[model samples]
Target: MKTLLETLGFLALVQGAMGLLHEFTDWHVGLVQRVGLLDGHEVYASVALIVLAIALFAAAERCEAD
Candidate 1:
């Protein structure tokens, strides 16, 4: 469970950062922009992802080691 949370948190952080990066610069990377549903909501999604990552990290920190 700890390892899973950490992995998910790391992935979320990366994807969120990538989304924001793609939005600000000409790098044009990440799945956020490619989603048809997101459209102009890429930034929001990115921010949400970052928030999720933070929460996941917190949860992982609280988890007991097996």
Candidate 2:
């Protein structure tokens, strides 16, 4: 379970980085513009990634404690 959590956390971090890049470059603008939801997608993904990373770090600490 700990390993799984770590993996998920890593994935989330990577995804968040990508999302940020997209936002910076307006890479996803075309898609979001079509759907009319581009204004806040990056912020949401970034927050989610940060939460996932924190959760994984906490899980890792717990595993080490055990």
Candidate 3:
């Protein structure tokens, strides 16, 4: 459980950072854009990613505490 939470937290943080970078910068050459996952709505996708990252990190912290 702890490992799972930790992994999720890390993945969410990395993806969130990537999303933000792709949204504001000219770095639109990645798997996310390739598959049209966050194609048109980069802002929304970035926001969702940031929220997910925060939640995942919180969950990981809680799991570690327990």
Candidate 4:
């Protein structure tokens, strides 16, 4: 479970980075653009995903310490 959480966190972090890139840079990914979150606020969705990634990482660390 800990490993799974860590993997998920890592994936989310990557996704958030992609989203940020898609939003700020000329590079655009259709998948991230189609999220339809916050009425097309990709930045919000990306930030949310980043927050989730952090939480998942923290949870994984806590599990390991237990």
Best by TM-score: 1
Instruction: Please identify model 2 stretches exceeding 4 Å from their true place.
Output: 27-39
- Full-model lDDT for every candidate: 0.94, 0.68, 0.70, 0.84
Give lDDT tens digits, candidate 4, residues 1-66.
899999999988888888888888858753566665555788888888899999999999999999
**Residue-wise lDDT of candidate 1 within 1-66, one digit each (tens)?**
999999999999999999999999958888899999999999999999999999999999989642
RMSD vs true structure, all candidates:
1.5, 4.1, 2.0, 1.6
Question: 23-51, model 3: which lDDT tens digit per residue?
Answer: 67868643344447656876676667678
For residue 33, model 3's alpha carbon misses the true position, in angstroms, by 2.5
Clashes of each: 0, 0, 0, 0
Q: Which parts of model 3 have CA positions greater than 4 angstroms off? A: none
Task: Quote each prediction's TM-score.
Answer: 0.93, 0.65, 0.72, 0.86
Stretches of candidate 4 exceeding 4 Å from the true structure: 37-39
Arranged by TM-score, best first: 1, 4, 3, 2
Q: Poorest 10 consecutive residues of model 2 by lDDT?
A: 29-38
Q: Rank the candidates by lDDT, best first.
A: 1, 4, 3, 2
Q: What tens digits encode model 2's per-residue C-alpha lDDT throughout 2-61?
A: 888788888777766666666778676322234345555656756667678888978977
